[model samples]
Target: MSLLEVSDLRTYFYTEGGIVQAVDGVDFSVNAGETLGIVGESGAGKSVTVRSLLGLIDPPGTVVDGTITFDGQDLHSLTESELRREIRGSEISFVFQDPMSALNPVYTVGSQIAEVVEHHTDRTATEAWDRAVELLDDVGIPDAAVRADQYPHEFSGGMRQRVLIAMALSCNPKLIIADEPTTALDVTIQAQILDLFEEIQDRYNTGLIYVTHDLGVVREVCDRVAVMYLGEVVERGRYEDLFNDPKHPYTQMLMRSVVTPDRPVSSLDPIEGAMPSAVDPPSGCRFRTRCPVAIDDCSTIEPPDYAVTSDHAAACLLYDDDFAGDPPVLHERTTGGGRDE
Candidate 1:
């Protein structure tokens, strides 16, 4: 069974300007021990989607529709307080983008981690502190016992991230939601963090949802991927498949824009234009205005998820038989990892 399943999830913010449809009709699931990457440009609603799963959206924003099911239980039915007391740390945990901000400077690293442990489990104060040190050790922190007593500022960026990871694992959550966890670190540190994530997942068999816009990170870590555009998933498939044979034009453009070993920087095709405002996104297919191959009907009709394979699909009309005059030739992912016409 899937560890977490989100269907038709919609989260909107009530503002004087208009309702910002941050996450509109999004659907994806993560199975136990599997890693799913949600990739998109800024404003694609990746963070909001994950936040909604944990009932973390506060005032001015709310989950308007759909269900969030984790471990076969409907999370939407729980009250915010109930979610915090029961689910947030025990069954699911979050590793936010900025570790420095997430940590409280006034508290020692061990105290912060121990606080979470004490809240979720029946461990005593002394035991919780012990567990915090052990967790820090588990996440590769050197001299974890000594580091645990140090304040957040004492640790470097990468070390602080490790502390956050340790805290996330404190309660042995079934799933972990990491939002751009390594975005701020140097490339070497980023690589190490990615390796650490894979290592931790393997050790615990924990389901993972990694939210990132980095194609390189997606390629390295994700088993399956969902490509978001203007608040909707435009394409999804196995990482290698999506990376090479991107079915949706948006996905294709994203692939073309990234730097690869074979594709030189000059030859790379950067996607044009910024993402449209979510409050007033384009009609019908949200990506139509930016899609290079958009047809006339694309403006009038929103395409459904067209199956390219049993496990791969794209929400683009170009893949549908009636929409395209001729049966469109599906792009093949060449063995060399280049976009072959």
Candidate 2:
């Protein structure tokens, strides 16, 4: 069985205006020692989906339906206290995007990590401190022992990220959810952090859920890719399959926008139209409003995930065999001209 399986998960916020369906009917899985990247635009519900998995959604927001099974244990069945005591930190951990806000300015880095270790494991305070230093060293932090005593401000952006990673590793959790962990760092530093994540995953044999809008970052780290739109997973498959042969129009647009080394800056074609608001998302397929290949049925009937291959699936009317018309071709705009696919 997979290490984590999320089925038709739905998380909605009861706002004064209306219900904002942040995560509506999402499904995915992560295997042991595998990295699954959830990629999408800002309002695609990538972060909210991961937060829902950990039962971290606050007041007004509720996980109204679906099952999140981790190692055969349904996470939704556990109470807040039960999740905190048994599941969170010990069984699964989270690494947030911004290290500056994640780490407390008042506390030394080592103490922060040690606190989690002490709370989640049988290690004594002293033993936890030692483990914290070891974790810092493992994540490639220099002068680990001395740096451990320093405050969050004392470390650089990359170092602070490493510290957060160390804290995530404190309890030796089976799964780690890193939500855009490299977003705030420089390109060079981002590469280092991504490398560290891969190393940690390999060394610990832990399942990893990497949430990021950067498809480039996903290409470097993730084994499988799930592309979310508005609040649903529109497509999912092996990274190579999804990257090389995107079956969904949104995914194709995302690929066309990627700044590859060979592709000039002028070749980038941004997708038109903003994402529909979650409060009242577009009916039928949420992406139909912006989909280049959207058909008449796409505006009225939601397309179920259709199999593009045994392992690849996409939710689009274009993939339906019963559709008689020719599929709309996407044109990649270039500097001099447009290339039709």
Candidate 3:
């Protein structure tokens, strides 16, 4: 079984405007030792999905429906205390976007790391400190002994990220959810961090859910990729299949925009139009407004998932039953017929 299985997960925010369905009917699973990249635009629900798994959403936000099963146990069914003491850090860890905000500024980086070990395990302060230092060393931080004494501000953005990673690994979690982990770093540092994730996953056999808006990073670190549009996943396939041939309109548009070093400067084509608001996303297919091949029916009826191959699938009317010829056919049919009630 997969290490983490999320089915029909819906995260909604009860705002004054209305209910904002941040993550609607999302389903995916991450197997042990595998890396799954969730790629999308800034407001496409990638963060909300992972945050819900950790029960971080509160007050205005709620996991309205569905199940989040981690290691055969339903996370939503666990008590708050049970989740914090048994699930979080112990079985699952998170590497957030910005270490500056994630790590307590008042505390030294070493203490933050030590606290995780101390809280999760029956270790004394000194033992936890030693383990924290060892974890820092494992993630390639030099002079771990002295660096552990430094504050978060004392480290560079890259180094701070490394420290956060160390903290995430302090408990040797089976799964790690990294949400835009390299966003604040430079290109060189981003590459280094991605390499670190690959190395750690290989060595520790940890399941990873790497969430980012940057498709380039996804290509580098993911075994399989899922592309989300608005609040739903529109496309998913193996890395090679996704990059080489994207079936969904949104995924194809994303591929065209990737700033790969090998690509010609003129070949980079950015997808136009901002994502629709989650409070009232576009009717039918949420991505229809921006999709080039969007038909009248696309805005009217939600497209059913179509199998491009044995392992690859996409949600778009282009491959729906209305289209003639092949099972994996792509056609341009214009009609905005089915609108969500």
TM-scores, all candidates, are 0.95, 0.95, 0.93
Question: Where does the lowest 10-residue lDDT sum fall in candidate 3?
Answer: 332-341
- Each model's lDDT comes to 0.89, 0.91, 0.87
**What tens digits encode model 1's per-residue C-alpha lDDT throughout 43-149?**
89999999999999987999999898899899999998899888998889999989998999999999999999998889999999999999999999999999999
Stretches > 4 Å off in candidate 1: 326-335, 338-341
Q: What lDDT tens digits, residue by residue, belong to model 3 across residues 9-59?
A: 999999999999999988888999999999999999999999999888987
What lDDT, from 0 to 1, does candidate 1 have?
0.89
Tell me how candidate 2 scores on lDDT: 0.91
Candidate 2 versus the native: TM-score?
0.95
At residue 151, candidate 3 shows an lDDT of 89
Stronger candidate by lDDT (2 vs 3): 2
Worst 10 residues of 2 by lDDT: 332-341
Can you give the lDDT of residue 174 in candidate 2? Answer: 96
Residue pairs of candidate 1 with colliding backbone atoms:
none
Can you tell me which runs of candidate 3 are displaced by over 4 Å? 325-341
| Model 3: how far residue 76 lies from native, Å | 1.5
